[model samples]
Target chain A: MPVLRGFLWLLGFLLLGETLVTLTGLPVSAGVVGLLLLTTWLRLHGGGLGDIAAAAQPLIAVLALLIMPGVVGAFFILDALEGQWTAILAALIGGTLLSVMTTLALMRRLMGEASAPGEEAPP
Target chain B: MTALLDHLLATPLLAIALTLAAHAAGTRLLKALGAPAWCPPILAAALLLAGVLALLSIDYADYRRGAAWLMLLLGPATVALGLPLHQQMPRIIALWRPLLACLPVAVLLAAAYAVGIAWWLGAPPEILAALAPKSVTAPIALGINAQIGGPVSLMMGGLLITGVATVGFVSLGARLLGIHDERIIGLALGLNGHALGTVRAFEIGPVAGAFASLGMSLTGILSALFLPLAWRLVGA
Candidate 1:
């Protein structure tokens, strides 16, 4: 029940977040704004966000299930997709690689000065 | 046979049931195979369900309409990102300087790499828009697509493919850089892959999971704010 209540609060935050996004013309999506708001509230209130995580864990674990319907809808546009497949493949693979590499490199640099250098190999 | 399949798909329950069942089967298969990265259960489930839908002669729209309720979960799931993020606040705050510096550049690199590659390939505007947020989480990517007037289906597709590729790419990057700190690992995963990246990070350990959560949220927020503005600035 407490977990349920926490989820309700989370939903309420999502509603507010969506509303805020619509009104303010923010770049952040409703869901993301909801994330920030809930994080802020949890930070301020001294309550762990664990309950919400626990409540949502099962559904969240299967993250792909929630969006596959929308993704599969792409089948209807295969003709268009075919033309763009090269671009799509390039973008997804290259973009992810660049960002991941940059972030990891930067993180390593930070860890180098803050702690022992060369802390890469961990078991 | 067509009439029978149509009848089965008539109720919203069928969408829910089919999704759950497919995912369950996929999960079981993965478990039996020791959950290899090449065939994540979710991707397998999506493929299986899509194949099944195609076999039944049920179109995408019909399946999505029946799956509308499940779609509603996207919002809550995005909200759930806050939990893991909150837990990682301390480490994030401690490492704020580097993260703050790295985030915008990372977002820009990601957006630029995607748009440039797609544009070079002569992708149309809709595909360009869909691919723009390929590194962002699904709900956020969808939102970006809506704002940019892109194809939502394509956005979802791009997001999924990018996510699935993220686990492998980040690890490969780490190996090349000789950086195996779980923090870097998690950060790379989350920044590039979003939620799926975070999931991969969790497999590594708690520290990796926590940082990956932070990376996912931070990159999302940064890209959401800066990517469009940069998009507008460059007149692309």
Candidate 2:
């Protein structure tokens, strides 16, 4: 029952997200808009909604699994990748490296040195 | 016998069962191997399924018919991120300044670097477009791709590669760069790697996981809203 209620909340948000997009014609993801809305709602509610957690945990656990089928579809279109292989490889390797480094540098600069992992966060 | 086989193949049940079975086997194999970070169970399952389908000559479309049901759950799973985001709100609220300051720059740069690199490599416009949203989660990336006229396959390909590569970069690169703070590491992971990075962040710690989700959700929402508009403005 808790799980069902959780799904209801999720689907309800998702529907609202879709409607929002349709009405506003925003080029955004309905699921993501739903996520933002739910976060706001949860914040406003000011208490843990255990039912959503109950449903959300299991799904979160297997997130990679849920994404696999779509990832695997890339295999079928291997031919489309025939000529662009080197470009794809370079972009992934270089772009990821640059992006990671950029974020790290900016974060370290802006946020300053963070305490080590096990320490309690600073107030 | 032929009719029975045809009927079985025609239904989504077989495909769904195969996906579950393959995922189960992959998880077992991963556990048996001590669960390496570089090789996520989902990658294992994907490879296993790919091998099986190739050997059996089953069409991908047929397989997706059933697997699409599994994909539907992603919408809710993504929304479920709100729970953790809410749980971590206090910390997030505390760090809101750095986070807000960092998000737009990081998000746009992540997209820019990817598209820039691909373009410099002489990738065509469509490939560049596809690469623009690769750092965000797949659904949003795919949605942005659809709007901007990139091939779905290439976008998916870029997304999978970016996800895996970001994990390698973050796990190893953070340590190399002397980053001991899991918050920064987690934020970087989620920012550059999206959901895959978020998963890796969870392995680091709960705090890292929470931050990763925050980064990932914000990145997705930001990229989805802006990238398509940016693509048009760039006129590429």
Candidate 3:
């Protein structure tokens, strides 16, 4: 299928995911669940989604562009966000750093890689 | 002419145009600056857009309406994650155990860290609830927060902060930890970074991007299922 069709195919899965989220009371959003469903579908059928992948690359390349409105919408809650700024920013910082360290440690232990080398990270 | 220009500027399309231009400029600037991983392109672009809108005295709602179509595509863009996940199926299956073992602990620690620190700062329970799923992507985080009885607006703000911080700090962390493997970098970023990290993953390379997508999906699925339940049961 052409890229447009590929887009429609992805859109179709998104709709299905939305429907599932609504009907099944799934905890996650339709989009992520839909991605899971699509992956499962492709894996089951011997896995050929390169067409859609290629089609979506352009859109994904600019994914950040699509996310701005929501960030800007952060304006809506600015008043609520005021007093909590310290806590919120701190939690985010702490959570993020902790997540990286924890994941790295766990993955290192599981993969059993020696963590003793390469202090000089590439720029 | 001024009336026509003013009318055009007021439309949603202008929002889209401004965002695209800012992103392009940000991308170019990053490339010129040797594309340092710490300086997120999206953050730069968002800052630029936010600044311009502030200067122009435009409301976020108007910008959102102008860019409604783009926002709607966030779903499809997320669905597009399947493409990469599908491509990475073999590796995904092979690394299933490591993923399963590592993600739960990692996600739990993140949620705990977020909520714990916030609660210590005397933040309300709803804010704590919103912060629980901060590591997950925005869409899934929204669902997770809703389940946990969090305030939706707070969750959005928290998720954005998590994303920007993830994008900004991953490289620095890698440097300090001496972690150089692309797979590890990508996984760490996507695991914690959410969509912004996925974008960073793609920025570095396709292989990293693929792994980052996997990390992102795993984190989302796991956190969505586990965080709310754990938060309630554990009384954290």
Candidate 4:
């Protein structure tokens, strides 16, 4: 039953994702939309999703590994990137620093407010 | 024998095997080094694999032929993020007002800061455009770059770097500030780090992971909607 339930959930997720992708024409990917749909249904229904989520977690956990091959392709393009190295470096270093600063500032503000009187910090 | 060896090497299965091996070795290395949980195995694997490919002078297309299955999984994995968001809906609902306010601000700040700094550093126009969407996840970031005529390779590099830096630094930043709340930490990581940050959050705890996933998904949407307009306003 657990196995069957898992399969069904996977099927549902894929189907919904495909349907939404076909419909929306938005930039968001279909699989992402499918995941959102499943999540919403699981949240509202609260059935056997915990088990399903548990099963899916490990696969999703190592997702970065899945992109590694694609990233390795970077080596092949080194010469092309070489000519533009300065610009690439600027974008990476500059973009990263800005993201870090922005993240820190927002977190500080949110934490400050949420910690205000009587509202216990969320565990 | 050489033809058979080449065929076996060219298969996607080989790429998957290599990736798994690299990831396992990288994680073990990090553990041995007592690196924090936020040290991403993926980032390590990418670096190591790039070195291997370059040293051998293998064509990327051959590597990609083997590794493209990884791309297929990206969609499904992105969808699965919904489960965590669903679990955390109550907390998300409670913080809706602040979250709503924070979403656009966070999105704009990330996009602007990346572009502004890139420009200030004298990056070329194409590089600046590519950096504009670096905070979002790969699929969306790639799409946006393509649409805007940015360099796809540069954007991919930016995405990987952004992910690693966010994962690497968020925990250290939180520890430095003496702020240990998992939810806040996760939110910050997700908003800036995207998927890589969310993975880091999961190591902290389920609650942190949940919030991180929520923040990641929302940030992707928010950035997609507002980033272009923000870019226009900045005249970039």
Candidate 5:
């Protein structure tokens, strides 16, 4: 039953995402939008998505590992990257700093207080 | 027959085997260095595999053949993010207003800043377009690039670089800003770093991981909805 619920959650989310992408023409991928919608719905209803969430946790935990192959795909185009390494490095550093700053600013505003260094929030 | 044998033996399966071996070794090495949390397995794997491929003179296509299964797993892994989001739904709902407001602003700033810096540095249009989606997750970044006339391959590269850099520097940046709150640091990392940031968050603690997941999901959604409009405003 737990497995069935997990599978159903996956199926339902993918279908919902597909429908939204087909209908709305949003720039976002349907899968992502579907996840958001499912999350919202689950939260609003409460306890409904519990079984599925439980079943899905292990799968998601190692999600990063799954993308390793794609990362390895970089070898296919090493020459192209090597040629543009300078621009690539600059973009990465500059973009990352910019993102960090923007996010920090947003956090400061939202929390309305300075957070202590290395203080983990309560769960 | 010799060529075929070599191809079979030096395939992506070999690459995967090498990567996993490197990750195991790297983890132990990192732990020994007293930097357990900073042991970036992907980066280590990439470096190790690159060395193996260069030494063996094997083409990437042969390697990709076996490694492609990893890519396919990406779709399911992304879908699995739904479970975390679902579990944290209550907190997300309570914080909806602030989350929504912060998301668009964060997405726009992230995209604009990347493009702005790239243009100032006289980067090519292709590179600039790719950098525009650097802060978003790779899957969505790929979609955004396609929508806005950017090169998907370039965007993927940008996404990789961005994720690595974000993961590398997030803790340092937080400390520099005197941010002691793990939740904020985690949320900020996930919001901007995507999957890579989430990994970092998990290293910090469960609470940080939860916030990171929350921030990542909200940011992905908000960016998807608003990036197109942002492109139009810039007349791109």
Candidate 6:
């Protein structure tokens, strides 16, 4: 019953997101819109919603599994990828390294070396 | 053997069952082997599923018939991220100024480099579009891809690869730069790697995990809202 309640809440928000997207023509995922809406709701409500957390935990834990099939979907389009392997590999490897390095440098510059006040180094 | 394979594939739940089973086994195997942070369970599960599908001569379309049911859950799973983002609000707020400063620059660079490199290499427009949002999580990446006009499946491939590569790169880069701050490391991982990076961040520590979650959520929201507009503005 609790999980069902949580799911209902999630589904309701997802639907709300879908409605917003259709109405406003937002170029975003309904789930993301739902996530933002939920975050806003929680902020306005000023506390955690236990039921939502309960329902969300399992889903979040296996988030990778939820995405695997889509990854596998890549195989379905091998022809499209054949000639583009060079580009794909270059973009993936080169782009990832660039992004990671730039983000690290930026964060290090903007945030500095120290942890936040009252925050000890994580063990 | 062929008859058995056909009947098994014909079963409505076959894809879902295999996916769940493969992921579970992969998780266990990784745990048992003490696999490195970059080698996520999804990687192993993907390999397992791909091998099984190939060995059985099963079509991805057929496998997808059942797997589609599982994919439906991705929306809810993405929404679930709200809980962590909400719970970590205070920490998020504390770091908001720096994070906000870093996010747009980080997000744009992440997308730009991929799109730029691929474009420079004469990759097709479709591939470019797919690469544009590959740094974010899959749900958001797929959504952005749909709006921008690309192969959603290829986008997923890009995302998975990006996630794995970012984790490895971020970890190694952190070490090379002597950056021991978990927050910085975690944010970098999540910003570039998305979900898989978040998973690796958790392995580092709770502080890392929380920041990684925050990083991933913000990147997803920002990309979801911005990438399509950018794609359109570029007249693509």
Q: Give chain B TM-scores in order.
A: 0.88, 0.92, 0.91, 0.91, 0.87, 0.87
Candidate order, DockQ descending: 2, 6, 1, 3, 5, 4
- lDDT of residue B59 for candidate 1: 79
Q: Is the docking of candidate 5 incorrect, acceptable, medium or high quality?
A: acceptable
Per-residue lDDT tens digits for candidate 5, residues A52-103, read 6655666666655666656666555545553666766776778788778778
For candidate 3, write residues B38-141 as lDDT tens digits: 77877777777788888877766677778887788898999987876776566557668887788778777877888888989999887888778887888888
Candidate 3: give the clashing pairs.
B12-B66
Question: How would the candidate models be sorted by lDDT, starting from the highest?
Answer: 2, 6, 3, 1, 4, 5
TM-score, model 5 to reference = 0.84
Instruction: Please name the candidate that would achieve the greatest lDDT relative to the true structure.
Output: 2
Over B33-150, each residue of candidate 4 has an lDDT whose tens digit, in order, gives 7865566666676777777666655557777877777777776667667776776677778887777777778777777777777677676777778778878877767656655657
Give the interface RMSD values of the models in order.
3.8, 2.2, 3.7, 3.3, 2.8, 2.8
Q: Which segments of candidate 4 are over 4 A away from where they belong?
A: A1-4, A46-51, A74-77, A113-123, B1-4, B55-57, B231-236
Docking level of model 1: medium
lDDT of 4 at B102: 74
For each candidate, the alpha-carbon lDDT, in order, equals: 0.74, 0.83, 0.78, 0.70, 0.69, 0.81
For candidate 1, write residues B186-212 as lDDT tens digits.
888878888777777777776687677
Clashes of each: 1, 0, 1, 2, 6, 0
Residue-wise C-alpha lDDT for candidate 3, range A4-121, written one tens digit per residue = 8779878888999999889989788899878888888887884436667666788778677788777666555777675788898888898788777777767766755434322333
Q: Would candidate 3 be rated incorrect, acceptable, medium or high by CAPRI criteria?
A: medium
Clashing pairs in 1: A120-B180
Off by over 4 Å in 2: A46-48, A116-123, B1-5
Q: What TM-score do all the candidates reach, one by one?
A: 0.87, 0.93, 0.90, 0.87, 0.84, 0.89
By TM-score: ranked, best first: 2, 3, 6, 4, 1, 5
Poorest stretch of ten by lDDT in candidate 4 chain A: A114-123
- DockQ of candidates 1 onward, in order? 0.50, 0.64, 0.49, 0.48, 0.48, 0.60
Instruction: Give the local distance difference test score of model 2.
Output: 0.83
User: Could you tell me which 10 consecutive residues in candidate 2 chain B have the lowest summed lDDT?
Assistant: B1-10
* Model 1: lDDT of residue A20: 97
The residue-by-residue lDDT of candidate 2 on B1-236, one tens digit each, is: 55674687787788878888988999899999999877777778888998888887777887898788888888888888887788778878878899889999999998888888888889999888778888998767777877888777777888888888888888777777788777788899999998888887877777787789988988988998888789879987
Candidate 6 residue lDDT tens string, B41-143 = 6777788888888887888889988898888988887788777777667767877888878899999999999888999999988889888888888766766
